[model samples]
Target: MREVAIIGAGMTKFGRSDLSLIEIMSEAAIRALEDAALGDQKVDSVYVANMGAARLNRQTAIASALVDQLNLFPAMAEAVENGPASGASAFKNGFQAIASGMADVVLVTGGERMREVNNLEATDFVASMSHPQAEYIYGVTLPALAGMFTRLYMDRYGVTAKHLALVAIKNHANALKNPYAHIHQAITIEGILTAPEAVVNNPYIADPLRLYDCCPVSDGAAALVLTTREIAEKLGKPIVKVGGIGQATDTHAVHERPDPTELTAVKIAAQKAFQMAGIGPQDIDVAELHDAFTILEIAESEEAGFFPKGEGHNALEQGVTSLGGKLPINPSGGLKAKGHPVGATGVAQLVELTWQLRGAAGDRQVEGAKNAFACNFGGFGNNVVTTVLMREE
Candidate 1:
């Protein structure tokens, strides 16, 4: 297989958007193409990643629409959906096309305009990813699952609400440096968890998970221009190689997992990615874990091998994961603060890493970052896609 590298990356600001799904995606794609400086080069294929446009926007054939919108009529166009991991799944498909000698230049874009519907409807649309007979029928929202998971993790690992609040505080502070992050408001532990008005300020969404613990439902888009190594070098852009990509799945129902507290899919997928990248978690300079909920960041960090099985919060408390620390996680604010546009999240994570590797991330940049990793979690813990990226010397 030929080596693949990313030449350009771009993303629309995350938050509620007035633009249509295709328009937002096209805007991101154009930004990426311009960043790549492809000039006269032709794109061989285009992949659009999205979870719910048909239900929310009442639109279909989004990939074809994006092609026409971008004036890339003859390029191969396809839509990919894998619950919340749709972005990474589409990226994997694009990577395969280039590696298999089927395409030289590929455009992978992920976008979701989830704000078109009401909050309850959007929640239900996302909940459709759950198992019909086991989860969805029981009205199991993601937060409920995360709440239960957090409770179990706390009991098993000594993580407390304070630890979870710390996660929120850290990520919120980081997001202040990110211009594209969805939530710009600064939060303090006292304000959210301990202050007299805390109960009303950060009300509990689920038993253990509060409003601040959840990622906001957002509308946004992100895009990447990927090509062969030769093409990347010729373009005179920083060569961010797609070092390794790994994916794994578990039981569809959260109750079916052998150990509910263990994110088995994240562990297996991260191991596969590390193995393929010829490195271990220790070698990762920065990482972007799936932080849809505050607990997820801690849980995924441990599962991804960044910390011991029950010690992720300890690492957080020690400042190991803070920016400018030993290893910064989520320098782009993460889903906790960056916004979780389900379809756009995975791709957005890569875009942030690409910027960090290129030394272009303004204030949130992790200095001297060479190797970066990302884990895009889907359907509770059932599906996941992990990626490793290296800045070529």
Candidate 2:
């Protein structure tokens, strides 16, 4: 196997977009090619990750359209969808293409225009990710399941709504410095505490879960160019190596799991990645955990071994997960503030980590970041993709 390196990365601001999905993707793909200083001719293939075009945009076979639009007529193009982890899965394919010597360079992009649909329609669309018989048929939206798991977390570990609110405030503050973040407005600890009762009250989206705690529907795209390490150094771009990658899946039906808190797949995937990277949680200088919901950041952090069992909330309260703290998590404002355009989120996490590892994250940069980890969870912890990235020496 060969070492894979990220030669370039680019993304459009994650928010409501008037442009069609292909248009948004072209913007990102072109930016990536420019950033890599590589012409379209250098791209050997393209892998797209998008979960909603068929239902939301009335589109399919998007890969062929993308290749033609970009005039990459001779290059192979395909799409990958694994619920929300589609982006990371696409990246994994690109990485393997380079590592296996099958392709010298590949372009991986994930884009979604979720906000185009109304709230009710959007809710039904997202619910498709759940099990047809057990979850979707019973009308269990993502937030409703998250609320149930959150209630379990709160009851067993004493995690409070205030703790979850703190996660929201922290991420929003981080978003303030991120020009590309979806929700850049800052909210105070007090603001979140009183959010449930305010004039434009953060309505109860689900029991114990307010609107503020959930990631907004968004439209966005992210792209990355992958090649062998030697090629990257020759190009004189900042070096970020793909040290390790691991993925795992659990029962999609939430009820089938004996323990909702475990997220067995997360632990297994993290362990595989850490082992492959030859590092531990302590070796990671910065991190980007999946924060589709505030509680998810906490749950993923704990499951990823950043904190002890039932201690992730305490770690947050003590500032262990803050930007300047022990391990800076989600300096990109996370899905909480940066927005969660489902399919785009997994690759977007890598974009942030790449920026941080290269010391290029201007205002939100973590000091002395050398190694970073990202976890992209899918379908309420039913599936996950973990990547360990390091600054190439």
Candidate 3:
């Protein structure tokens, strides 16, 4: 396979967007192309990742509309949906197109207009991803699944409510530094968990999981321009290679797994990604985990090989995942506070890692970051996609 490099990354601020889905995507796609400074190079293919546009936004055939919106006729375009991991899955498609010598320049963009619907409607729409016969019929929402998982993991790993709150506090603080993040509020354990009336402030969304622990529904789009190494060199920018991409799936129903606490798909996909990158978790200078729920941050860290099984919360307690710590995770706030716009999140994680590798992540920049990892979890960890990037200085 030929080497591929990322030359440009762009995204709309993740929140309730006044623009339509296509407009939001156009803004991100155009910004990415402009950042690439492609000169006269024609885009070979365009891929859009979105999970809920058809139901939430009353729109379909988004990729076709996107091409026309940008006047990029004659270029191939398609839509990809893989639950919440749609963005990374679409990114993987673009990466393969370049690596397999099929295309020279591919544009991968992921976006969703989920906030267009009310909270209840949005919840129902997301719940549609559950196993239809075994789970969705009972109206199993993602938060409910996450809550059960959190409860089980806590019991097995001896994780405390304090540990979960720490994740919220850290990610919320990180979001304050991210200009494009949706939630700008900084949370504290005392305010959300320890105070006398904290219960009222952070009511339980699902048993053990509180309001602050869950990511808010958002609307946004993120884009990246991928090309051969030669194109990146010609563009005159710092080199950031797309080192590896891997994906895996688990049982559609959580109960079917031998161990619900173990994120089997995350472990398998991350291992494959590392093998392809010729690197290990310890070599990662920075990382971005899917933290749509706070406990997910803890669980995914272990599954991704950043920590031992059943010991991820210990690492969080030791500050191992902080911005100034040994392996900073989610410096862009992650989905916890950065907001999860369904399909846009997977692509956004890469955007942050790319910025960190390039030393462009202003205040949240991981010092001397060279190797980066990202885990995009989809459909309650039933599907996952992992990506690794290396910076060539």
- What's each prediction's TM-score? 0.99, 0.97, 0.99
* Residue pairs with backbone overlap in model 2: none
Name the TM-score of candidate 1.
Answer: 0.99
Per-residue lDDT over 237-267 for candidate 2, one digit per residue giving the tens place of the 0 to 100 score: 7889998998899998988889888888888
lDDT of 1: 0.94
- Candidate 2 — what's its lDDT? 0.88
Model 3: pairs clashing at backbone N, Cα or C within 3 Å: none
For residues 29-79, write the lDDT of model 1, one tens digit per residue. 999999999977899999999999999999999999999999997999999
RMSD of each: 0.7, 1.3, 0.7
**Candidate 1, which segments miss by more than 4 Å at Cα?**
none
Writing each residue's lDDT as its tens digit, candidate 3 over 1-393 gives: 989999989999999999999999999999888888899888999999999888988999999999999988888999999999999999999999999988999999999998898999999999998999999998788999999999999889999899999999999989999998999999888999999889999999998999999999999999999999988898796789998888999999998999999899999999999999999999999999999999999999999999999888999999989999999989999999999999999999999999999999999999999999999999999999999999997
